[model samples]
Target: MAAMAPSPGRGAHKHGVIALILCLLVLQREAWGLLCYCEGLCPDHNNFNGTCEAKPNSFCFSAVETVYDVETDQWKEERTYGCLGPDELGLMQCRAYLTKHQRPKNISCCNESDRCNEHLLPQIIHHKPSVAPQGNFLESLLLVTLPLGFVALLAVIMTVWFRYRQRESSMLEYNKPLGLVIGPNDTLSDLIEQSSGSGSGLPLLVQRTIAKQIQLVQSVGKGRYGEVWLGRWRGEKVAVKIFFTTDEASWVRETEIYQTVLLRHENILGFIAADIKGTGSLTQMLLITDYHQLGSLYDYLQNTTLNYFSMIRLSLSTSCGISHLHTEIFGTKGKPAIAHRDIKSKNILVKRNGECCIADFGLAVKYVSENNELDFGNNRKVGTRRYMAPEVLNETINMSCFESLKMADMYSFGLVLWEIVRRCASESGDRYLLADEYQLPYFDCVPPDPSFEDMHEVVCVRGVRPDIPLRWHYNEVLKTMSKVIQECWHANPAARLTALRVKKTLYKFHVSDGTKIV
Candidate 1:
């Protein structure tokens, strides 16, 4: 996208917006429905100045995009004005949106009164190569440019300061990953059902509108792809993952996967928005999701030990989530099977309900049955060192086969299960037993932050696995769990149990042992 100069009409637009907002606040809400002014790219092009009534809960939207006219060598805006469909989540989903450049793109939504979205909101565009037209006066610049520049400058400084300090889980040390659309009487799920939702996630337009509305609360954690921060929008806390510009591919891939048809599940990270913001060299690529309290499964296990029942819930919920990812739907709106290549404890988050959901899709692969294609999500598939499967460590993985990747995930899941179970406190008939200190898989065999060579030597060459305590055998449920873990991390990838099989095995314990999966 080429950066260009500021649009000349920007000054007039701001005055129009202030007046527009004031008018919207005073106008009475239409009793029947919203009546929006339809113009430009209206459904009935002939009736450009027509007005249309919006359906219940729907809002008014208007958009303008400056398109380059190749033949004329000039930028011309394509306008869209009408009653837009209901946003996937709720009426509150509507937000102000704009893209910077000489050729700017602007879209806005309003529901305060009839014809509330007649004009797009004012936006400051940066990195324009040319100057504003001579006709735009000094007074116009003073009134519009000065105050907007001050606010923008202050915001940029704060964002940079918070971002510069972003690294690891020290900031959100007490936080956890809260599920977006789950728990008792989840209102967000009902919002999705009531709206004209695709049952996937928020639409791209809605997501982009939301991107600028978020205010970073604090740095949550950092990783290879980017740093994550807790952010707030309209009093609701959300997770904002700001990726390095070089990791742009990962951001796009995760966004695409999250927007997959019918992909919204209780056990997967809840995606809210994906956006690229800022100007020129200072651009930021961001992926926003719902914020849960505890940072990650690894962080949670380290800070808080769990009871046996909580341990089982985490294990079972995780397997169920993975199973949904692995299984492909067949309908027209079906989703292809996805394999989460990096499935370590750090990538799994524990919700307040004592269940785990999978996160991090930068290295995920999707299998499309229609064309028998494998999408590696445009990343150089790099498995985590500590949770590397035997085949992955030895470089024997069949990248061509989708099942090969799924099997590798099982191996990582086994390591995560071990992490969770190690913190579980259980009781035998005759004795009370508490688990040992939380540790990563192969903590004893390899040094901290193991290299590829170190993991290869420890896992593939030595044929080693995480040890199970003899005390685990005393408890019937723990004994069964230990067996399942063994099968998942088998030396042979094909020999490893499928995700569904693992979920079934854990589900059996849930039913017989009087423990709940939720």
Candidate 2:
């Protein structure tokens, strides 16, 4: 019927073949059921694509683990999926194994699926807080380096400034003319120019240093301003005119006149230096100048007599001094014409060479023609009473006329000549005679220290002058001196002899007397 009563062998073979198909189907289902996804990040067990081939008797597993990164010094979470045995399927097993061996932060879950481990395990989602650096590397470097850089820059600047100042100081010291370079032939004017670049005077510091080194030896003279002292500087004698602080104006006036350009001359006292020294209330104002041991004409006349030659030298030298004072040089460096308002024997110094120089310029006045300026100095009446000319005694002189001042000086010069001639004894041609005792012009008419009133009465009111001795007429030199004196002391100032004329007349006499005047 369906298989012709089915042969027993064929039937058995057909049954056996059906059993083999069923067994193959069952075996394929068991093989597929046992398969796991086996994808993991493990380098040792995974392939190059971070996945493993499906394995038997294993399950899909997910693990949330932590590992210490030694280089980063931080805790990191590492996730992996791979086949796990039945014993590893429990959370505690994986957790304990990972915690002990792999240092896992948390255990895993297992599932049997194709890609059950594809998604990460759900956890508390603990995120590693990002660590922020304290400061930028560049900023930290600048903070440390910037201040040191500034300090180094400041040190360099200070060193440069210090060197510049040192160089400037060295130049200044080198420019100063020390006394060692000065020669015997060098004049003070030359020294002033060499030291100051302009012939202005000594530098202020040089003046102070010189003043400080001076040693006062003795008081030489006294005046209304203050005392005159003989001082020594490096064994060189110098006259120190010291004024009381109260009379500082007089000292300043004198110094100013002395410093006039082109004012240095043999007939003018040589200015050395001027300074103010000491501390506070003890300060002393000093004017330093060349000193002469012979003292003033007044002192010399009072102590020593003179011969005819000495007499002529004194009169002519005084005339030369006054004439030079009246001269106004015209050039780049010029001197204004000056008048010695207080000309007297005491204000004239006698040099060792028998010459004279005008001194005591406190009451002097300068006349500048270009500006028509007349400095009528201090108002104080300051001439020796006995030496006042007629115009001066009567206060009737023309103040504006420069010639009137010259005339007044001439009148005083006449009196000085009289004083010089009275002490002279002619020694020419074996005519040896002792000279008369030195006396002031009006010594007979007034007291030794005559008052202004006494002088005014004798000179202006009475029109009296020193009498020329009748004996002078006997000698030619005395007679000529007497004539010059008469012309100089005329009551009318205009009629007075000029200083130049007086000097010329004395020079002529020196020639006529068989003497060659130098």
Candidate 3:
């Protein structure tokens, strides 16, 4: 038996030609319905003119007119205008000789004007009649293109997923090679051991050591930038101020002011160590100073009760400290007139000897230029809102608006005095016995509400001032205190008493008394 021989190239060519012919036939059939008819050859129903003439309806007017009578169903020689078949009649109403009839269908049946109205009618291509596909061409194209588009989208998603998985795998490999994983139970010291073996642990250990060395015993107070901690440095009690590293410029300025001032006065806090030059970030910088265990004026007021005389002595000590900062001349440059931008009870520290000292130079700025113009443009609002002067809140004027730094300091000093008086007058228990013997009233009169405006408005606008209570009015110590508070809180900064004047006034008040002022 023999196998039949396979066809050669000729047979495949013939098959290809046949397929091409079939495709052409399908395309031709699809396009055949678009052909138009020859001018006068179509049947009346199919032609525009024929349909209008036969119907004699409103739609016939625009069709070409041929004389035809409906009743006889015959052609006539008479000429008529705008008498198209029913299909075109509505379109031909504007042509000459077609007086638009009320009833468009009632046209002449014969020669007589209205005689031909009897019911004349006449009239209107099949190539392939192909129905175009149900959807639009663009929509058909979209349907054919959708599968490829979906495949492309799927490919992109898979590529992204694979890349992400690969990166995660790489990260896991990198982390796993470190051998022993430090668990949550492991302390920082344990992590230091693990990291040290890999040469990455030393830096971490150093940071931890530095942080540990500076222990925060208690939070003394907090300000905008950071908080102050009563800490110990090398076993010596110290005040450690940990400022936010973000405010590097402010920290720099503050450090510069301290370095420039040096540790001169007994009442001013002396700087022992500054972390400004430390290797760590600025935020980690620790400002170390001698810690006065007596705490701040505000804290002292909270802990101890004092008679009017003791209160007066405390006020005098605070005034002396401020006076030293403002008036004590240092070097040929003279004392760089430093203004304690923030002066409240919290910033003043009391010592064991009952002497008060001014601390917290974070907001302090030196008036370097002789003009006394404070470069406050670079500074953020620093003082407590309650203690802020009205002018400070408005910030419309510069430091020059006040005649001297002492004047501004005095304004704050008044508030501090009032706080002292309030706390002293409110004391009870054994402290009250001591207070009573001093010939001081148990309680000083409550001061009027303070305005957060300019000192002028506080004095002139409000016409209100901190008054001495009737009980203490005749008392010499109370009288002196009343006078001092009034002078410190005077309306005009110029009119306000100077820190030096306050110190002098307190000295005279103390010297005249038999009791020793602390």
Off by over 4 Å in 1: 1-191, 194-196, 511-518
Clashing pairs in 1: 4-102, 4-128, 5-128, 175-293, 175-294, 176-292, 176-293, 176-294, 177-292, 178-292
Q: What is the model-wide C-alpha lDDT for candidate 1?
A: 0.78
* Root-mean-square deviation of every model: 29.4, 24.1, 19.8
- For 36-107, candidate 1 gives per-residue lDDT tens digits of 887654555565557877766677877665655668866665666777765532222222443333354466
lDDT on C-alpha atoms for all candidate structures: 0.78, 0.75, 0.56
Best by lDDT: 1
- TM-score pick, better of 1 and 2: 1
Candidate scoring better on TM-score of 2 and 3: 2
Best prediction by TM-score: 1
- Using Cα atoms with residue i matched to residue i, what is each candidate's TM-score against the true structure? 0.62, 0.61, 0.49
Better of 1 and 3 by TM-score: 1
Model 1 scores worst on lDDT over the 10 consecutive residues at 174-183
